[model samples]
Each structure stands twice: as C-alpha cells, then as structure tokens.
Target chain A: MDINILLVDDEADFVETMVKRFGIRKMPIDSAKSGQEALTSLAAKDYDVIILDVRMPGMDGLETLKLIRARAPLTEVIMLTGHASLEAGMQGMNMGAYDYVLKPADFDDLLDKVRKAFERKQLNAKARKQGA
Target chain B: MPRPANRAPEPASDPHGDPKGILARATGARLWKDHSLLLWAHFLVPPVLAALVVAATFATPILAGILAAIVLGIAAVSARGLLSRLSQTEEARLALNTQLIQSQKLAAIGELSAGIAHEINNPIAIIAQEAEWAAHLIGEAEKGCSADFAEVKDSLREVRAQVDRCKNITHKLLDFARKREPVLQDVDVVRIIEDMARLVDKEASYKNVTLVRSLPQDLPKLRTDAPLLRQVVLNLMTNALHAVDTGGRIEVSALADDEALEICIKDNGCGIAPENIDKIFNPFFTTKPPGQGTGLGLSMCHTLVDGMKGKISVASKPGQGAAFTVRLPRRV
Candidate 1:
C-alpha cells in the first residue's frame, strides 16, 4: 500500500531519528512539533495515516484527532503514548481513532500497524466510491 | 520578617560552625517550649476549676453558692474555647507533618529517577546510534566484499537489540518516577483488555507463549481510570510472559461479583523464590539479570493501581509459577 504519514511530537530528537530511519525504508513521511503544526500540515496535504503524540504541549493528540476526523474523515489516526497508560490509547480509539501504539515502539511493529491502518482507510474509500 | 534590635545578631557562618549562635538558638528554642507548655497548662486550669467549684457548691452558703455559679459559668466558656482552639492547632500540625513527609518522599523519588534516566539514557542513545552507524557502514562494505559477514551482521543485530532493551528499561524507569494525574472515565474492561492483548499478541507468539483469556460475558462496565487499569494489566501480563519459558501457559481471567472486579494473570513459568516474592513489588528490586530489567515495572503497576483506589497482590511458590491479582472497586 502507498502510505503518506505525518508524525506529530514535541520530542525533536526522536522525531528526527524516526524520520531518518523511515526515510531509509523509503516511506513517505512528514513531521510536526506541536498539535497546531500537525493541524496545519493536515490541511496542506492528504495523508493516509497520522501518528500523533498524546502528550504534546498544545492541542494534544486527542484534540488533534478531533479536528482530523472533522476535516478529513477518510484519514486514519494512530495515537502514540510515551507512558504505558492504555487509557490514553482507549480514549483515542473511542474518539474515532484508527489505533494506538506505545512510544519507543519497535519500528517493524509500528510499520506493520501503519500499513494495516492505511489499507483499512483505502478499503473504506473504495466502499464509499462503490456506494456512490 | 526582621529580627528585633534586642535579639541576638544573626549568625554569619553555619549554625554548627558558630558555637555562640548555636547555643543562643538552642536556649531560645527551649524557652519557647517552656512558654508554650505553661500556656497549655493555663488553658487546662479553667476546666479543672469549674469542676471543683461545682463540687464545692454543696458545702457552701447561699452567697458563696452564687459566687461559685458565676465562676463556673465563666470557666465553662473559657474552657470550651481553649479546648477547641487547642484541638484545631493539633490537627493543623498533624496535617502539616503528613504533607511534609509526603513531599519529601516524592522529592527523593523524582531526584533518583531523573538521575537514573539521565545517567543511563544518554549512553544508551549513543550506543544505539553507534551500532546503527556501524551496521550501515558494514552493509555498504558487504556490497563489494567476498568474505562472509554473517557473524558480523548477527553480532551487530544483537547489539542493537540490547540497546533497545536498555532504552525500554530507562523509559519505564522515568514512567515510574514521574507523577501522573490520571483522567478517569467510564470504561469497558473487556475492551481495554482486548486492546492490550492486541499490543502484546505478537510478542506472545514470538516467544511461543500461549495466552488464554477468560472473562464472563455478563461482566459489568468499570468506572475508573482506563489507562491506569490497562497499564496494571499490561504490566502483569508482560511479567508473566517473562516468567514463563517457551510453550508455557499464561491465563488472564476477569471476574466480578458484588463488591469488586478482580483480574488475574497467572503464568506457569519458573515461580518466584520464597524470599524474593515479598520484595517483587518494591522499586528497583528485580530477580532478572542486570541488563534485563530495571525492576520498575511491578512497582509502577502497584502505584497506578493504588492511585485508582484499587489493590494488587501476588501469590506464588517455587516451581509453581506466579499469579498476580488486581482488585478494582465496581462502582458501576
């Protein structure tokens, strides 16, 4: 599946490392430092999956998810929580999120989830098209 | 607040180093203690006098009786006022002491965890980066070289995995040390478990571990912090995975009655030692080797469960594996 991804987090070093690693894998990736920046990027481009940090400074991951669902219903959202609280993940899922992943996650594991989420989104789009 | 002009001059050096200031402060403290004791005795005297006057009224004349009545009335009012004020001050002092102790514990935990994270994570990050760089360079060189690089590649992979493991422990250490305000909500326990299982199922399979989940279909929804509860369960489940060898069985079962909902994670792995069982939940106390665990997982789990007004306990015997049970109040 062709997936365009956006990573939103306040941790610059983590983001840089992830972006470079994913770049080596030839995955299409973009990043933002804050929720506001994430929203701006979301408006500027169409991404299949948005990996959002739950503990950002302003407009946290949940709030950003709300705007994403409102603006682009077809776009899937994956929450990333640094701490091991599944509550944040569940909250995100309840708020119409695609899924959630823990931080410091294995890259292969994360990539597998991202691919599955993108495929799910693509299937939904195809269904909508067929219905129309 | 400025010191009085007649008061002794402030010490220019440490109290221990300045003999005169130390002596003066000690004397002043002792005098203040004596004064407070006298004041407390003064408050107690009125109540005693009131009781004595009431007892003596039976042996006195009519005029003396009237005088005793007035004295008793004034004493009663003063005694009541003093006792209430004294109790209030005592309560305030107790509360301040409790708060002081709590803050001290939190401060110490914060400092220790921060120190561990800083001291360990920086080195871990560098090691991981250097390993990745070396692997990259080796990959490039392998394109032209005819010699076997299989062992070199396998060693580099092992190094990277160890670095990642160190990173995970440091991250968990910071998680345990940092205080969090859990946002509570009405939660479906079943859903939370499913989510946690989804996250761990891959690893369970990779380890050849069998995960058996048993929950009643009629289980009621729980009213508590979902994330905290999920964390506690996940930690227990992960610990169970580690305790058992490949092909071992781990059962996660949930049951609820009238009082509380209980979730148990039981594994048929190498059971905890008799001496180590009691210390399992203590921070930095691990049975695992040095590089394998930071020993923060169970402690953090304990903290999270306690924060939710829940209880966590364990039962185990050598050669019988272990069982961790978490009890959460069933509000809804």
Candidate 2:
C-alpha cells in the first residue's frame, strides 16, 4: 500500500532535497514550509506519517505536534532537528512524536524509521476499526 | 465409613483434590503452633473452673461465691482486651481503604484532565487563529490609512501570548495523558545522565549553582527506552536546579546493583515543606506564584518513569534539602 507522507520544515533546501530523495525511491511525498502550512495540508488529507522539523519559523515543531496529534491521532510523526538539543528531544517524545532524528540523519536510517512509523499508523488504524 | 444422608461427600479421597486439604492442613498446623496455649486454656479452663465451683458450692457457700466473682473479673478483662484489639484492626483497614481510594481518585482525575485538555485544544486553536487574523486585518487597514493602532496591536499581541500559554498547558496535559509504550533497546544509562546534565549545566552556572556529576565509569548498560529515560533524568535535574539557592550545589549521581540501576539528583537549597512533599508529584500542585509554574513537571516525570517500569521517589526535610531518586530495573 502507498503510505501517504508529509514533510514539514522551514528550510527550503532541506525540504527540496528530501522530496527529491523520496521521489528517487519511487515514494512520492508532500511537503510543507511551516507548521501553519502543515496543519492546512493535514486538514485536507490523511497522512500516515509526517516528517516534522523541530525548529520552524512561526509555530515550533512541538506546538505543531500537539495539534497534529489532536487532529489525526493515527498519523505518526518523526521529529527532525539540526542541532542536538536534549530539551527539544524530550519535549518532542513527550508530546507523542513517533521518533526524534538528528540532522545529518542517514538516508537509510530515515527510511527505516519512516517505514516503521507507517506500520504503526496502519496498526493503530486497524485497532481503532476493530474497537469500533 | 458411611456418610450421613444430609452430608455432602468429601473430595479428600482424590489425589488431585489435595490442594484444599493441604491448605487446610497448613493453616491448622500454623494455628496450633502459634496459639496452642490459648486454645488449650480456652477448652480446659472453663470446665475445670466449673467443676471446682461445683465442689466448693457443695462444701461451703462463701468459697464458691469468691471463686465465681474471680471468674467474672477475668471474663471482663479479656472482653475489654478483645474489644480494643478489634478496634485497632478496624482502624488499620480503614486507613488502607482510604489510601487505595486516594490513588484511584488521582488516576481518575488524571484521565479526566487529559480528556478536557484534548477537547479544549480545538477552541484554543480557533481563538489563536482569529487573533492572528484580526492582527493581520488591522495591519492592512493601517497600510491604507495614516493611523497609529499601537494599542490595538498590543492587545492583539497579549491575546496571542495568552493563547500560547494556554497551548502550553494543554500540550503538557496531552503529554501527561499520552500512553507511551517503551520500546526496549540496549542503552548506556551513564551517557544519558551525562548528556542531560550537560543541558542543565549552563543554567546551573548562571545561578551560581554547582552541578556535580558522579557517574561511575564501569556502570552497566541498561535494557530500556532511551528517550523516556532521558526525559525523566533531565526533568529531575531541572527540578533540582530550580530547588537550589544561588551558590548552592546540585549533585547528579548514578549507581548500579544486581537488579536495578539507581540515579539520584540531590539539591542543597530551600528544602520541601513537610506538608507539601506528598503533594509535589500531584498534577497542578505547584508552590510557585500564579502563572509562574504549571506544576506538571514532576508529575509528568512520575508518569514517564512509571511507563518505563521504574520507581521515582523523593526524600526531603523542611530545612535539609531534598533528593530525588529513580530506580530502573537492569533489564526492562
């Protein structure tokens, strides 16, 4: 099954590269420049996983995560950061982000985490359906 | 032996039915061993005294009357003793029941607040969006006409700031409510503690507080979730930093034994008040001035530690500083 994915980051170059990389892997992905834009995209579509950057221009990644979780609980989020801030990492994990990845993240590792997150989302959806 | 017609047959003959028999035998043996003297006294004393009273009554009336009075006195004393013991047991049970109810109540409150926080998030988001939109419209109007809308802009700013604060509280509430199942991996616990300590080092220095690390080089690696442990350790260290006074000292130490790994954060500052110590880990139980603290930090730490299958505890005296310890199993 195709895993609908969204990447949210403020850095234009980083988002561009990520989009191209995923495209090369035959997995087309959507991108958003900021938390506000991410929320707008989320409102329109159901994404299985989101690659969110911790540091954003307007609303930071942690704040964005809270809203995303509230809106789409089944959607898993993986936090991306340029610097290793322990504080941010703690907050991201506590806020229910699927995982935290440091910048200069290895492509293979990121792919592995994305696949894992997508699997969790699928399981969550199945569980909810069964519960209902 | 023939059983009575109204009596049920016994299961004691079946070998597989020996469980109940064994339990009964064990309990009977224990009772005999612990209270043999009392049991013997209860059976023998009453009849022996009755015989003696019968003999004395036949021989002399005064002797029989004195013996009967002594027996009555003994009975009264024993009855009082039994009554007091029964009340003590009742009191103990009541205390236990109260403790159980208190914990259950806290759990319910935690769940309710989480639900409320989740429901409140949507409205708070709309309010924030409307505030932002209003500010945007005001800016556009100013561009078209020469007008100073500084007061209006300031009010909008305050509105946005307040919304952000509300967002913070709700987000924390959601976090506290989040049920994170730990994904176990081999983790270097000492490294996690050191990393978190580094995060708090600059803040500690700014307050002239000394942050000490006493992690041993040979401490064993733990099998647990890394991020959750890191969150717990960092939160505790931050709390210790906040507790200490200027030029005070905070110590972060780790040690391991056969079964569990223990990390302690000790602070030498104004100690916890005796009355507030128990409530410190309760959500929304903060001593800080209004709007200064959400009081979720320690409680969140408590929840996280519990999720990791660890124990978190505090030892404090009113004037003698406080120490917080987290104990995690070597393999979890």
The best candidate by DockQ is 2
Give the alpha carbon lDDT tens digit for every residue of A45-116 in model 2. Answer: 999999999999889998899899889988989989887676687677666777767787788878977886
Query: Residue A74 deviation, candidate 2, in Å?
Result: 10
- Tens-digit lDDT track for model 1 on B1-332? 32122223223333223433433343333333445876676677766766666667776767557767777776777678667766665565565455345434534554465566657887899998998899898899989978777899899999999888877667556545554434445567876776687666767887898888897777888877655676677778888988999998999899998979999999999998999875677677898998676777787787677667676888998899999999987763
Residue pairs in clash, model 2: none
Predicted model with the maximum TM-score: 2
Q: How far is candidate 2 from the true structure (C-alpha RMSD, Å)?
A: 12.6
Q: For all candidates, state DockQ relative to the true structure.
A: 0.05, 0.15
Score every model by TM-score: 0.46, 0.61
- The window of 10 residues in a row where model 1 chain A has the poorest summed lDDT is A85-94
